[model samples]
Target: MTHLDHITVGDQQVPVVTTTSLVIGTGSAGYNAAVRLAGFGAPDVVMAADKIRAGASRNAGSDKQTYYKLTLSGSEPDSVRSMAETLFSGGSMDGDNALAEAALSARCFYHLIEAGVPFPANHSGEFVGYKTDHDPRQRATSVGPFTSKSMVESLESKVRRLGIPVIGNCRLVDVLVDDGNVRGALFLRTDVGAARSAATEEEIVETNVGEEPSPEPTGTLVEQLAKEPSRFLLVRATNVVMATGGPAGMYSDSVFPHGQWGGAGAALRNGARGHNLTEWQFGLASIKPRWNVSGTYMQVVPRFVSTDAEGGDEREFLSDVIDDPNLLASLVFLKGYQWPFDIRKARDGSSLVDLLVYRETVMRGRRVFLDFRSNPAGALDADQLDEQARVYLERAGVADLAGTTPIQRLRHMNEPSYQFYLGRNPGVDLEQDMLEIAVCAQHNNGGIAVDGWWHSSVVDGLFPVGEAAGAHGVYRPGGAALNSGQVGSTRAAQYIAAHRAEAPEGDGFDAVATDVFGRAATLLADAVARFEAGAEDNTGTLITDVTELMSRNAGLVRSRASVLEALEQVTQWLESYPETVVVDDSSRRSVNRLFLIHDILTSQYVYLHAMKDYLDHGGNSRGSVLYTDPDGDLPWPDQDLGLPEEFRFVLDAGALDGVTQEVDWNGAGEPVFTWRDVRPIPSDDDFFENVWRNFRTDRGVPARQS
Candidate 1:
């Protein structure tokens, strides 16, 4: 490979290089794969993102980041079959990937602990587990609110010890592909420019230092930002693993770190097959400093209240709308297990909490807040909380909090829940004030499609782990994303190692580089042309439009008319890309933002289109992506999927597998979605297995093959 751009590394110019395998995104998944590859002695490299904890895994935290695993050290006699059964349950969209994930979850969990992740465990040497989301077993555990962050910390330490080459502050902007095999990736070193930008920011006093600084430019008032200086390194790799997470920050109402768009477009542009792009997960969280307030936060059952701008009538809003106050309090307790908004629970009081919160914040004119200093109207009595809530409180040893203030109860219970916030440099005292909440796009259960081993089925030599891979369907078990990332990345690493020597690097290097270069050049030329033509900067406007559209049309609730209108607007923005103004001349931040716009638009194009198709093909509500036709009523008053008894609109999880969408780029690089039947991962209970084996034997295969 030739040197595209040069950068001084401690006064030495490091040229572009080649590696056997390249792992993009330095989050948990990417780092895990890189370390595993290094363990196998198959040379690999990692981009130590702008900051060690820049991506979603490191930055985002919640009441408790659940880490779901098997019985392991727990008292319950849980088996892999039982684990897989729970994994496929809960109306989570189908695929046999969950079965494989379940089979591998135990090993992955232990792997993290071995790598120095400090998960909570009992003195008897058993890792403690708790219930989360849609799990029937006590398979979830966490270390405060930083489970993902702790995993990242452990993985980073291991990577450093192994001496796997890390190009810190680099971004994998594009991948070089020839004959459908990934040749390498083009990475831009943004650290140098970032440091320069930071030095400029140091002159300002009112800046959030050490944080992902706001997208503030430091240039002359009249001059548009010049193309910020950068060092582009094109690494030629035989295998490329895109462990970057899903595109979560594309929407404004998101809990992900600012401007962190998962690099999905790099694969989409190469005509890679993307599955489940329509199935993103959303929930309630604090908006200012984004964080999920679930687990113990909800378990403590804080007072749900909202206030107007003037702050006159302090009201427990749920009591006003819901007829029964006891049911309202119980539903608040249920929010602990039912964190994500489930459509089937829409009418049921379980999911009504989310609807009322969203309604209070968005639909109604009020700012919703969860006050820990107080309790709900009738929460004084021990009988008010259901047996499940009391059981959890007893397990957490906070059962005595029946008559105490929510904060005092939380203090005796999960100290780290509040301590985690106070541990920040300029700490937050949750005891004093209420935490503002909003419905934000949290985890994405959708992304690039992969086979059982997590290798991209269409783009050979390309593996997508973590959120980058669409292994998750609809709703994930609370901490399953962490487990899935570990499992998927390890599988990707093992697959790459098994075939490392066989990868052909020299076969079509020139051809791959030519095409990648041409595409990049065309985009750059268009950008420059637009800048020269006095194009107005509509990137901000576009982001607002995209975020609001997704929030209103395709968010927690959806209607056909609203989605079609959103589609029309998104289409118009796509057509207006030529006239879009991107001020990159004087600022690299602007360039990054411009690139982010491109990435989001590309990913959203497929997402919005797939959603339209999903509703068109009689796809009803399941997880967060609820579809309501404007002309017709909801496919509701139905009961299935282990749903709460009070609600309607339960999507048939079994029927979901037969109705799936595949997004592929055409000759013009525009995505076209086609519906396909994906193989479903049936529950692997002992009885189901025997019957399935018998059925297979009845068909053709021998029973012993099972």
Candidate 2:
């Protein structure tokens, strides 16, 4: 057990302090909460986190717009009402009301614009829009491809302008809750050495913002020490908003390194870390699990097609000859590559290909090449092509090859052909173009379930926003994530503001403070003992283990066996965690230790809970498949049981304890599933209407009829 020498209260090391609201994350949602609360005249809003903008908001591709089209896509006509209903149907929905309120406050975009966010605009000054894969309309509005960065900058600027004090690099150790209400949080500054040595260099770069060169001699060690241990800042509040990004740490395998990938889906797993709040709510907008589905359905764009010396179209011949889906699938798997170009067979038996710029090469040494040699040179927009070329070169550390055809040839020659064409004479190049092929992790429609007002059922005074909250049903429309964040945050702010004034002062604050400090003391003692014993038992290993387990068992493809395996792995990790301890030189006053511990525990709980629910729901193929074997076969445990078709209802019911109700597929058959419940549709509208209706009612907005 850990022990504490003292606790700090105000300037004195005593015990506790209280405030009006506590905003728990530094991302878009947290910032929104603080700013909104301040605007609404809430006193003393405190924003806490290990790092702000380090969550999904910072890592997002920032496709700005309401993904109304994707939400409405599918065979059955889906409306706002149906969308909301499905979001809430699984009891995982939270913040429906908040989302609705945010929809009403669409002018928040204008507010962001005023904050200097550079949204893409057209010649007429209206927002420019583009279409995405699942979207039914051109709703995505981007500022080049770095929209997430731009938005983060704008939000950070606005937060500073509002005079909101942010304690960066500080991690919350524990939430102080009393009588079921949040009082404050325990915190610790993460010791620089505690993070992996490799991360120290990155940390330095991140923290050296706007520092000028020093001409004088460097300061002494004593001088640096005097400035060390920056004040342990804590803010007590009556209300708290959890805007931590999604559970990326929880699903580390599926998510790309921070800021490397363009999709928001992979970042949703970060919310898993925040699920530890004892009194906080948990819910997520449901979204279609496409990352595990269409994401694996590989397509390629041929950059340069080869032709024979006779000048016959070699590219045409290859397209005409290679029309087998099995061959294509095999090629994609063996080459460890996905095509960049959209290849389609024409009615005349030739291929119509839309060549795109190449992004990254596959392991098979096949460079993504775009075949533009056959087209008139410069027929395509030169500026757009140049921009893409620059982006690829910068990311891959390649030199300028603009307007060079040989570069395309070099890339194409290095690529391997499918087994079927191994002995065939590869043709000569007919066209040379750059092709960008990226196999990115996209879409995490799964998350903490939320209602119209992003609050958790398990805990009050806790709200989740952005990708953390699961509101998008089975499939999220392309632009809805942005809408969810903006609207969810705004609505959460409204709820906090409205309730803060009426919240009765209680003993929960003191009790919460005591509990938090007690836990911190225990952690500190554990660290000290670990140090004394000269043992290295940190939470990172456990976290990594969980991540590996999730990747192996709960990723891309899933089956009964894999889900069960994941559940078993989670249980084993939990059992092994208690024997582990993190050692840090940083004082107990900091929040680093608290943050790490909370994150690890929360991650485990949320993932296990989610898997439990997912397993409980036994249907045909729904959401993303998590456990498909290498041979691409589903492995259900009871395949030969020959149970009634209705028995499969367990799959659609989500996490079933004794309390939660099962999905009523019989009543709302059309939207929830395609075919019969026995043969589930890959994607269907199971609970959209109910989820949307709740959202509409929560926001006091008129629900759109289906």
Candidate 3:
């Protein structure tokens, strides 16, 4: 392990105590990294984060477990390799390494179950799987819809059992590096509000060094003004692993709730610092040709049928008009026509599946109404249906379900579902609902470019896992994110362990710490200046700008114009960021203002990167967004974005202009921003036959036997 230099606490320098393998972020990736390191007998493994499970791992709607069934129509037989290729198929950057990582991730689910995760199981004790939109297989496994919750609980239990030290509510402001290798990190202990004031004063002292030290430390003033006490912590370690999630909170509106956005904010701020350090000492390599995340995959479960005054099921009527082969397939699977069916309708023929999907979309302020109100059964046994509905409503925290009719209940359930489930309802809705729904920003399929071994070309001793790494390609299959986290974490841990002996003793550890602290102090000073200038007081304006841009331009639909407009708005926000201010309250140590500032900055980074990628790969709506352009002006071919190339980086570097550049697609290096040769689907008779076969097989319901 690397030896620590002096620890800084409110201008007081303390000697290093010990060193450990430090895992940053406590979500799935971080947890897995710590667990695997401990399993390998790495001494003094410490996992730290601002908020552990509060990130994407906990905020995700479902656990989504399998991808074997998500093969593109008429593609080769599904295998781990084939799946990887498909995931990286698009011109969007990501490469083969993502495929290997995802393949390994699939096995992680089994590992979770072995660790006593208690995933939903059938009577036979086999894991019960269900179908979701985008995937052809009913391979998704969950324990209730709160798969993230269950997964977090199980991992948390495992971490505790290992007796690994976990420091929560602490932010890692900087990573200290020496001689092109990672040595340790600088952290701000955030448990005590009063301590934060002291730390702020210490920061001022550290910056003003070489000059006479202030006789009366400004930290004292911070204490006098603070409403609560704050504490700061610093940890020094040999190895550091970044398992931070994506940037969502910085954006005004996201598919995830408010809290989930903070992870993105932290990652953006801290990641920028880490990347910068790596760039200065060691040349950085990044996967280029980033994949375009056009929009979220949306499906709405049409459970409740809207009715007239007399009450009628409009859904059944509309069902006749719309050829809902997907819905029928679900019914067939649930009725024992397939191997993994668990969904069952109430006695009145109502299913929670539709309601769950409907409520989620409604809460997002999107339009979702059922058409089955005119059907004859819409009015059938209102009282009995209401009773069954009551069971679900109560569980969802809908106390007023008793007074509302089924149709009315559907409308009322929207708010509560959003408040509770993060915009998802389980069992009561069909997975098909996700197919046609509008969405807020959900996942970033595009991430840092990496190789098959999970190595970033930009820097050594730096690894990104889970959502932070971006290995899933353009569109990830359900449950694949969990798989990616496990795979990346495991690979990273193995690499670190194997290379531990060869790692050089870092030089200038103290100097690196000083630099890191210096940067953080600068950021804080700028933030303070903004607050004092009253330029940062436009919190409401910033919020409104972000919400409008994201909702209108980056939502479930997209076009070049809208995307460009959104980018323009993001640019303006970024320009205005340095001037933003904090109100300077009693809780200077907690630094909610700093948190928000970081969040906004990171959100802008993601938005700008995504927009640039979208423009580079032009085509009609390919994934979730519909492209109205008849000519398909996009430069990249219309092939399904595969995993390998989309996730791996061959070269990465930051431009002098501050824009980060990456090279991907098997060392094709930096993309020329030109169109590629297009490939056409074969017209052979077997093509259609195979398509029919796979479609029928995906439903797991027999179409016809040979």
- Top candidate (lDDT): 1
Residue by residue across 1-706, what tens digits does model 1's lDDT show? 1112332433334334566777888788988998888776565454434334467887777777778888767567888767776766644344567777888888888889899999877898888787777788788888877778788878877877776655544555676777777887765555434234333321221212255432222222101112324344566777888977888756777777653568887788776788877777778787656677776678787888799967657788877665455566667778777778777666444776887777676666688888998777754554556778867777876676556777887878778878765654335578997777887788778788888778887878888999999787666778888888998888777767665534346768756665555554456557756766787545556666777777766677666676788778777766676456454444555545555666676667777777788777777777775565343332223423232222234454556744567778732545677776656675445577777877674432122111
Model 2 lDDT per residue over 368-453, tens place: 32243432222222223334333433454332233443234234322322211121122122233222222223445444444455
Worst 10 residues of 3 by lDDT: 278-287
In model 1, which runs have C-alpha deviations exceeding 4 angstroms? 1-15, 46-51, 90-96, 192-231, 308-315, 377-380, 390-403, 425-427, 502-504, 525-538, 630-654, 657-659, 667-670, 680-706
Q: In what order do the candidates fall by TM-score, top score first?
A: 1, 3, 2
**Model 2 regions lying over 4 Å from their true place:** 1-17, 62-102, 191-234, 256-443, 502-506, 537-540, 582-598, 627-706
Candidate 1 accuracy as lDDT: 0.68
Task: Name the weakest run of 10 consecutive residues (lDDT summed) in model 1.
Answer: 216-225
lDDT of 3: 0.44
**lDDT of candidates 1 onward, in order:** 0.68, 0.40, 0.44
Q: Where does the lowest 10-residue lDDT sum fall in candidate 2?
A: 281-290
lDDT of candidate 2 vs native?
Answer: 0.40
